[model samples]
Target: MRNLAEKPYVREEQREVQTVRRQIRKTFTRAEKGLLTLIGAAIVFSAILMVSNYASMYTQNQEISQLQNDISQQQQYNEGLEHQVSELSDPERILNIAEENGMELNEDNVRVLQP
Candidate 1:
């Protein structure tokens, strides 16, 4: 402050203005902006994919359950058919069917075939 304008300062006489200084500057161009947008879109897409996967898994489980129920019903139906077959063991049904086709029950009238 003595004579800054009248005399020149020495090289080591100048004092430091600040102990530390920090500054941050950010700049965005069209390409950088587009990159940020793409990143955001990718995050959203990932979320959608996760939701879709969960939905597919849930639907598959439901389908499996329905198929198991269908199998149980079909098994019951087959068992009922088997029971009916066991009950119809009388020879009268066969004789009636044979007579309807004009087939006689005589020993010579029957043809024997073996496989």
Candidate 2:
């Protein structure tokens, strides 16, 4: 029919007009292009900063963990040395050693020194 042919032609013309409108909308002005470029750069810079901060934090945490382990090992070693010192300085052990060396305990000859 004649109307059916005209309908197809009208739809084609409408489609062409919409395509031209979309192309015009897609075109950006100089100022808009500059603003978009600045926004993209800012996003990239922020991402870089975030990654750098995370790396720094991770490194610091690892250092702290290693230091804690070192401190724990040092404390354990110090405690062991302190126990040995206490055992060596026992009064009974000192008396036995003095007897073995033929030294007698003389309270009157002992002098107390104060710091």
Identify the candidate with maximal lDDT.
2
Can you give the lDDT of residue 11 in candidate 1? 72
Report how far residue 114 has shifted in candidate 1, in Å. 7.5
Tens-digit lDDT track of model 2 for 6-67:
54543344444343444445689999999999999999999999999999999999999999
Model 1, range 10-113, lDDT digits (tens) per residue? 57777768767678677899999999999999999999999999999999999999999999999999999998897685568888888999977897777777
lDDT of each: 0.89, 0.92
TM-score of each model, paired residue for residue:
0.56, 0.75
Say what the RMSD of model 1 is. Answer: 10.5
lDDT of 1 at 85: 93
